[model samples]
Target: MMITLSLSACMLRQASLCIPGPSRTVLRGIHQSGARCSGHNRWSKIRHRKGAADSAKSTQFSKITNEIYLSLRPPASPDPALNPRLSAILAKAREVGYPKSNVDTAMNKALNPNEGAALQSITYEAVGPGGQVGMIIECLTDNSNRCVSRVKEQLNKYGGRMSPTAFLFERKGVIKLSLDPGTDRETAFDTLFEVAVEAGAEDVKVVLPTEDVHDQVGGFEVITPPSEVSTIASSISSPFKVIGVEVAYLASTPLRLPANEEDGAADELETGEGLGDVISEEVADKVFSLVEGLEDTGDVVKVWTNVAEV
Candidate 1:
């Protein structure tokens, strides 16, 4: 005699099992298979990639929101026209596709004096892996001890250590302006060069649009004295839109890295021994990881490195 047992559909679905009468053939088949289907594996990979992307976007949004709050602190006005720094931060938020609601929320928090404790700004200097790259991390937090501890932890975890790296950098104002579509690059550069110089700019260079800069066909980076940042940005005329303006700690002497082993080998050949200044790709990756980790920390607002490029 064959015995029969009935299982509810809900129970079977919850257990990811199929029961037909009293037969165990389906269970045996699944057990023999052992591994999941290819479709499931593909879906898992896609989910993981999406998770990483979402995490990056979240980090960016959080940083921008913090910036907005900081920009509205005492001595800074809620009106963009009165606060150039706030204006620049808002422009950055829009460029990154930050939601308008979030911006308004940050502003509201800033405007309320009792919303939270006053934020204090701090800067931490460190040397990255290989001791070739110097970094300056800027942060704003209500608790200095907590912020410092977190920064130190990230630095230690990523092969970096706190040290005096500030001497490697100089404070300067950086303004990035995008050229209007159909505008002649050369003409715009020439016009901006003259205008920037007249507005006390230190230097102006044309930056060709890249994958990272999708908003314009081309742009110009104007370096100025820290106090002249807003003056220069406001001085820009039509055909050029100011995209970013900030007082930044720029590397005084950028540390150049070899693009490949061949380049390093060539440098070593030129010198009697291995080039002490050049860092390997592995070390560069570690430095980049350290910077990313630092930026991900809640208090960290900006991270600058002496390394030219990665």
Candidate 2:
């Protein structure tokens, strides 16, 4: 009887996956499968993957909450509309699908630390495989020791080690903008570049993945001296909308990961891909896994690395 009921649930789940919107009759037929068959192993696999994804998403939201809370620290107003920096951070938080309630809770915590344990920012540096990858981990944690231990555990697990890698990177402001599709490419680029340069921006270039290219100039990134980031971002107007603006740790020297020449060639042949792409997808996946592990630690706020972003 127990097996029959379990099979019924699995059949219902499988039926739901097969049918975009399973009707009442289809659902009833799914229940009938329990009487004839008990084979539904795929349900366990599907459930496991869903559970893992939900857990990861939960951890990510917690980290974002810490960021929202940290952004609301005293001297900065709890009202995002009144504080430009906080407003920008809030916009970023919303872009990432952060809940408004969580944002409000974070603001409340910031306004009243006595309501909860106060959070503090901490930075840790680590060197990745071949000392080729350098990372500056920025964390907001109530318990510094716990954050340190978790960070160390992730690095050690991923064949990385903690060290003084901060010197390897320079702080800079990075702003991402969305360009208007109706505008001329050359004209838009020239105008935004001119505006950024005048505002002390060091460089400006499109930052979208070529593999996901569209007809229009979707967007671009602006790099500036750390202090000038906000000054330049605020100056960008009209055709270009500011999507993201934040201080970033840019590598002083280029990353020297072993080029996956063979994979690159294969990918290009298969999909017309180009060069200067990050270390191969496999290596990038591994690096991302390490990064995700660090982020999963509740204390970690943001993880930055020299490994090229995909």
Candidate 3:
């Protein structure tokens, strides 16, 4: 089996600035085997602001440093508007409870003349315990050694090992759309169908729902092959909000794990437990934590795993 596994900044002058915003596995007891990142939205031409934070922890400056000098190599602009990836990174940072001030400092430093962070692309390919396949973990980092070490440590702890055929996932386009709750579900479905057909989006998933009763609509995630993202965005009407758009890895084919006797195998097609139900929360947390730590190392960018605990 195999598993494949695979953020932000801004600033204000003086006191200012702020901003905000799965699955696969191979087989039982099988040793792991072997993963690419593809995108043309180059981010090397934006201008970044100067960083404001000095502390090590809880500092956007550090994150930005990781991005520019470590993750975002080549010292490009930190402007999210121009850098699609950075733009999403900023949004993700905010969503994760990152401080606004820290976000600013990171952006500020990326554009600094003295701060030279060389952006490098990294891809990790590994197999899992079963016959499951894997995908590439695309990352931008400054310290390849630290990133690899951290990733290896986590996988080894999880009863999985990084092997040499996990490239089964095809990188796809990602579109985060803010769903309109006010609209009827049928209307929403209509909107989705219209936009998807016009823009060529592949699928949609529910991310998180808004707690606000009045807010009605929370949001839905839209996915497309990397090539069709722009067309879908173009087909969308302006009243609907476009949260973030970028290229990301998505499994070309999904595999299900066995559960109780009721569970069906691939041949059944209509019957089977998805990875969501089979993977333990403890395992999820561990893997996610591993990802977070590697991401922090500033070199490893992506983690793609096909591991599903049944």
lDDT of 2: 0.58
Write candidate 1's Cα lDDT for 105-190 as tens digits. Answer: 88987888577787778988999977878899999888999999999999889889988999999999888777888998656765
Best by TM-score: 1
Which is the better candidate, 2 or 3, if ranked by TM-score? 2
What is the Cα-based TM-score of model 3?
0.56
Candidate 3 regions exceeding 4 Å error are: 1-89, 95-97, 108-114, 130-135, 204-218, 227-231, 234-239, 261-298, 307-310
Per-residue lDDT tens digits for candidate 2, residues 53-93, read 22466776886677667656656566654544566677767
Show model 2 residue runs off by greater than 4 Å.
1-55, 73-85, 92-97, 209-217, 256-286
Arranged by TM-score, best first: 1, 2, 3
Which consecutive 10 residues in model 1 have the weakest lDDT in total? 1-10
Compute the lDDT of residue 161 as modeled in candidate 3. 62
Q: CA lDDT, every prediction?
A: 0.64, 0.58, 0.44
**Per-candidate TM-score against the hidden true structure:** 0.73, 0.68, 0.56
Off by over 4 Å in 1: 1-55, 73-77, 82-84, 95-97, 111-115, 261-276
lDDT of 3 at 207: 31
Top-lDDT structure, candidate number: 1
Report the C-alpha displacement of residue 298, candidate 2, in angstroms. Answer: 1.7
| TM-score of predicted structure 2 | 0.68
lDDT of 3 by residue, 217-270 (tens): 545456676766655654665345566666666654543332332231211221
